[model samples]
Target: MALLLKEFSPAELDRIIEMAWEDRTPFEAIRHQFGLTEESVKATMKAQLKFSSYKRWRQRVEHCRTKHLKKRDDSITRFRCSRQRAISGNRISKR
Candidate 1:
């Protein structure tokens, strides 16, 4: 997992971290975009975040039903918010 994570640019890593933190962004979406499994995403978060932050993130993820595709509502189809504009150059456009 470390080697796989190494291939990402700093910006990509940041985006992965951001997506992991989003309640509605499932692990499948991260895997689709970054080729990381749920375990690998957890590893990336553990490696990149402080211990306290990692713990909090884990707790939050465990409680967030939307973070896992199977647990998410079928009505919610997209990985991102409907209000969010297209991403350009790795940056999500500001409203």
Candidate 2:
């Protein structure tokens, strides 16, 4: 089900967009707080942001700084919690 949007303000929407665009932010952050999935976040971004901005954000993430040890590809790496993995690495989510 789609998350209800009634309580959100423009400021909150902007915050969401900023968090989504931030390389350090995680999908789990939005998922935990707002019950939004990655797909939902993407849809929101597309609907609320300019096409050019969205494109740039996506490109930035696709070329983000960190690399995935197992995957060996930064572009495909998913930002997630470090506790889930035995090896120490940049955890996508934080307490």
Candidate 3:
């Protein structure tokens, strides 16, 4: 199993993982609610779920969620800093 760098409550962690597994629950949706990145969500999944399930889920996400990738790129961001920082394909674009 993968290790998480920080500890989370059972309920909080469970909800995040459950949301990650939902088809309608975009990474953006999770971020809007939790302020976590897609990488964070995937790391949480690897840490909490079985390896096979994680693999299948990643495959499903890559194949089925292309529109989300585009939408995620176009979404607005609000960071506490003077300017928000968000990236797509290593290029930074601000709202």
All candidates' lDDT scores?
Answer: 0.89, 0.62, 0.64
What order do candidates take by TM-score, descending?
A: 1, 3, 2
- Residue-by-residue lDDT tens digits, candidate 1, 1-95: 66867799999999999999999889998888888899999999999999999999999999999999898889988777877677754567776
Colliding residue pairs in candidate 2: none
Query: Residue-pair clashes per candidate, as listed?
Result: 0, 0, 0
Q: Lowest-scoring 10 consecutive residues by lDDT in candidate 1?
A: 86-95
Q: Please give the distance, in angstroms, between residue 35's alpha carbon in candidate 2 and its true position after superposition.
A: 1.3
Once fitted onto the true fold, the runs of candidate 1 whose alpha carbons sit more than 4 angstroms away are 88-95
Residue 66 of model 3 has an lDDT of: 32
Best by TM-score: 1
Ranking 1 against 3 by TM-score, winner:
1
Better of 1 and 2 by TM-score: 1
lDDT of 3 by residue, 1-95 (tens): 13343545576677678667666557776677666788988888887779999999899877654316454444434312344355343235767
In TM-score terms, candidate 3 sits at 0.61
Q: Each model's TM-score?
A: 0.86, 0.58, 0.61
Among all windows of ten consecutive residues in candidate 2, which has the lowest summed lDDT? 86-95
